[model samples]
Target: MRMPAAKKVKSLPPADVEAIFARFHEIEPEPKGELDYVNAFTLLVAVVLSAQATDAGVNKATKRLFQLAPSPAAMAALGVEGIEAEIKTIGLFRNKAKNVFALSQQLLERHGGEVPADRGSLEALPGVGRKTANVVLNIWFKQPTIAVDTHLFRVGNRTGLAVADNPLAVEQILLKVVPERFMLHAHHWLILHGRYICKARRPECWRCPIREWCRYEPKTPAPNGA
Candidate 1:
């Protein structure tokens, strides 16, 4: 796809971007992370289930799973078959069930059934990737880590905030550009913005707050044909 021209406007300097984030904080000061979970263990399970699935879908599945098996020991004992039965509605339920069981086993053997705060340890678990590790680290441990999912990557590139090919590169650029004060909440702000407003196929730019800062061209809706 041809890259759209970013609308020409006064560039947002680092300080201006920081101010935007501050305003974001004021607007949604305690913007909670989307994925639902009760604790670290449950959080890990929820994130694993979230892959290739919507947060609403994952939450629907986990709402029952957590009630029955909230802890690693409880989950491990529940076994893959039992977990699969509960999460069958979610996408890739079988594979996710296997990974969740394996992750619980690793937690028991290595970290005494507690989710490790370290990125390396978290990623070492079955089905846990860099994005998952970043989410766990940032949300559970309060570390400043950005998990660049599709929404984030698109927003970063579309807004000319941090363009890159892959999530890792986008994440690195975001770390470098976003102010430290905004680092923790930046991921949520961007993700929420992209999901609700700056959608993939047809962005709802009319109600977008940062429309002026966007770099994308053809801002107005195009004719259905041609």
Candidate 2:
């Protein structure tokens, strides 16, 4: 297989960009994040723990964890040690536990145990960053913000949707190009597509719904041409 192109096309044409998302919407009309959360506060914590971890992994760890402490007050009661014990199965659980505990305290002390809708407020919480805040805002608050993770970064470049050197640049280009109607679920669509189809190694380009508009070169052939 050929190596991924070192250079990236700036972006697809507006029509192609529109069609790409249209295809995504058609394939999965109601795309959703894989993480399980009962409410905005739980969703916020789940996104924070998802750093460098798979959604499935985070979900598994958070299931009982959330059931035990579903709110900020309940989470704060867990303390760092208790939180760590529950999520130890995940990577960097100690640090994640500390962050969760601290953020839970902050939520209680600052926001009265409610998750904030504003980006700055959300990012101010412990363990929360731009990407995490964006995810929370997009998913829980119904904002049109795009959170650029590794998958989105790769897909944006490989598909010529919004190639850039870093996630922030890709996010900016996507914000400007992705249709307003699609912006709400754009990140989820791209993420699921990258995770299941346009993977980093051995992308399933043969069955990609948007292969016609995708600029990824040397598309992977189907097994024995099917």
Candidate 3:
């Protein structure tokens, strides 16, 4: 559902972005990724499935599938057909299934069935992109990497905190502007905020925590028809 449109978040200067991060650290302290997974391998798979899909959707699909194929060996054993049957509901399920199976085999052969911690190795795997690699690096390895997905792209652009055209540009801007202390949890905070509050549709300004810092158009009507 589209949220009520929010006023543009105030364009944050570099110092202002730093200050905002400081406040976020005080409030949430330790934000984490919303996608649920049992291990690094599972996290990687879940992220691959999450492209153009919601974490909730990926989690739902993985909840049962992961239990069945928790490891690379197990997933490879399942084969493409088995994996496809399991994840058929997700968009581009056929291709994703193929990638999942191929990646599982590659994992076993290349990394002893373990999900590699390094971004380069992770990117070498099928279906894993920079965003997926960044997510795995950040959530599983606790690296301070930003994975700018659509939510983040919108949040960054709409808020004017880190305006950019593509995810890569946004990622670069965020890395530069977001405070060091808030780097680890920055993805979660921005994603959650974008998902629930600063949505693409109308934003819910009344309950917004950072509405005061925003620069978008107000959702509420003026007191008088001026």
Candidate 4:
């Protein structure tokens, strides 16, 4: 069976974009990432483990792992095998375990047991990519960066806030469109919105807070028996 091609997304006008984010800001002035972590190191570890996995899953595994090895030095001491045992429930546990152990060692040896604030330094860590680096930078260090995950990508394109082929392109477009005041919290708001309201299978347009500003056509109607 041939699948229909995705519709071309039209970019929202600047005023519409501003109004959409204004509503978001009004609803939640301070949005936060759902990942559970104690410090920068734990946050980095949690994000690394979150690849191809949900935040809830990562939190469940990291609960015991973080209890045992909260810091870089501590995680390094746990060794790859120990880390593997702790995070075995998550997908790609073995490789993620190696990355966790190796990154911990790198932090200790090169960064003096600190998660660096710089993008280059953060990306240099094992298993860390652009999204992970952006998360750590924005959440931990207060940088205004949008990490384009699956949810954000969908929401951005669907709402006409950003229309791009890849995550990097979406990130750049969002950076250009979102207002300065809302930039820091924009990432969190968009991700949460996409995850809950603008779902991939069936977006709940009826209850969507920004439905008026959205450019997506054929909005799904409310199910029977409201």
Candidate 5:
């Protein structure tokens, strides 16, 4: 589901855009994603499994699985059934298992058992899309790329940050508007804000660090009683 039309806000002024990220940086100089992974391969697998599931859920299933198959060759050897058994707790386990196995084999055969550092090669792997590739590229390779997820889609339009109909458009706008200094951690900051304070259903505007810059109106009230 999408944010309601009633909540959509107009684009924020250029200064407010900068102020918002400045406030984010003031609060968290170094924002981090919730997903846990050891290496680039594990990060890729985690992102793949995290498509429609929560990071906590994916991490729970992959805790043992990653340990069992930390590399492409090891994961390929596990086969689809083995991977499926390990990740069965996640949603769409069957399809995700096949993807993980196939992608692992592809990595072994194509990139010599190393996760490619480029977008084209990474996106070629099974179940790896632009967003997944961008995540791996940004986090693993230190590229200043934005990987827009649902939280981004909502927060972008709802707060007049990017105000776009789709994720890519929002990403592009953010890339242009957000200052270079904050590009590296922009996605993490925005996603975490949307996940926590600037929530989808009931935005806790009273506590939002940058609510002053956000366009979404009718700030949510604090709960009754302390």
Candidate 6:
């Protein structure tokens, strides 16, 4: 069946945007990404494996995998078969295994076994796209970048924080609208908010902290017997 087009989100004014982000910061001063990793290399691997997978799923597999191969050299030594076996539970495991191994090799050969801080260098790695690179840069390197994942895209557009058609546009709009103090943690806040509250199918709007600031009409009511 053909789905209805997404509602055109009305843009929030600067003051409203600031207030919304201010609330996010006040509630969770230092929001963090759910994906678990030890260091930059592990973080890269985790993000790569999280393409069509959940953070909890990636963490579940990587708990042992990271212990087995914590470094690029170690992961390279583990080989594609080993990586595949470890991450087989995740979606696109075969390709993700190939990428993990190949990127590990590249890290050793070109980067001296270190994840590069530069966006171009990070994106050059296998399976590391703009989103992955942005995540690594923001989380590991403390860069104020918005990694426009499904959660962030939905939250940004739905709440009028950013009214964009694509992830890239949403990211760009958020970068401009979000205050500098909140930029570093903005993506995480939005991600967690969307994942738990502003859900795709049925957002729990009744108890939302930022409901007053949201542009989404027809706010969902409390579930029966709640």
RMSD of each: 4.1, 2.9, 4.3, 2.7, 1.6, 2.2
- Kindly list the per-residue Cα lDDT of model 6 for residues 1-226, writing each as its tens digit: 1122357878999999999989988899988889899999999999999998999999999999999999999999999999999988999999999999999999999999989999999999999999999999999999999998888888887899988778888889999989998899999999999999999999999989999999998999999987
TM-score of each: 0.91, 0.96, 0.89, 0.97, 0.96, 0.97
**Model 3 lDDT at residue 122:** 94
lDDT of each: 0.85, 0.91, 0.82, 0.92, 0.90, 0.91
Compare candidates 2 and 5 on lDDT and give the better one. 2
Q: What does candidate 2's lDDT look like per residue over 1-226, in tens digits? A: 1124435665789999999999999888899999999999999999989988999999999999999999999999989999999999999999999999999999999999899999999989888999999999999899999998888888999999988887788899999999999999999999989899988888899899999999988899998847
Q: Output the lDDT of residue 108, model 3.
A: 96
How many steric clashes does model 5 contain? Answer: 0
Identify the leading candidate in terms of lDDT: 4
The 10-residue segment with the lowest total lDDT in model 1: 1-10
Runs off by more than 4 Å, candidate 4: 1-6
Query: Candidate 5 at 218: error in angstroms?
Result: 1.4
Residue by residue across 1-226, what tens digits does model 4's lDDT show?
1122335679999999999999999999998888999999999999999998999999999999999999999999999999999999999999999999999999999999999999999999999999999999999999999998888988988999988777888899999999998999999999999999999899999999999989999889999986
Would you list the rank order by lDDT, best first?
4, 6, 2, 5, 1, 3
User: Of models 5 and 6, which has the larger lDDT?
Assistant: 6
Tell me the tens digit of each residue's lDDT in model 5 across 85-180.
Answer: 999999999999999999999998889999999999998999999899989999999999998888888889888989887777889999999999
Tens-digit lDDT string for candidate 3 (120-186): 9999999999989999999989999998877777778776777656678779989988878789999
TM-score of 3: 0.89
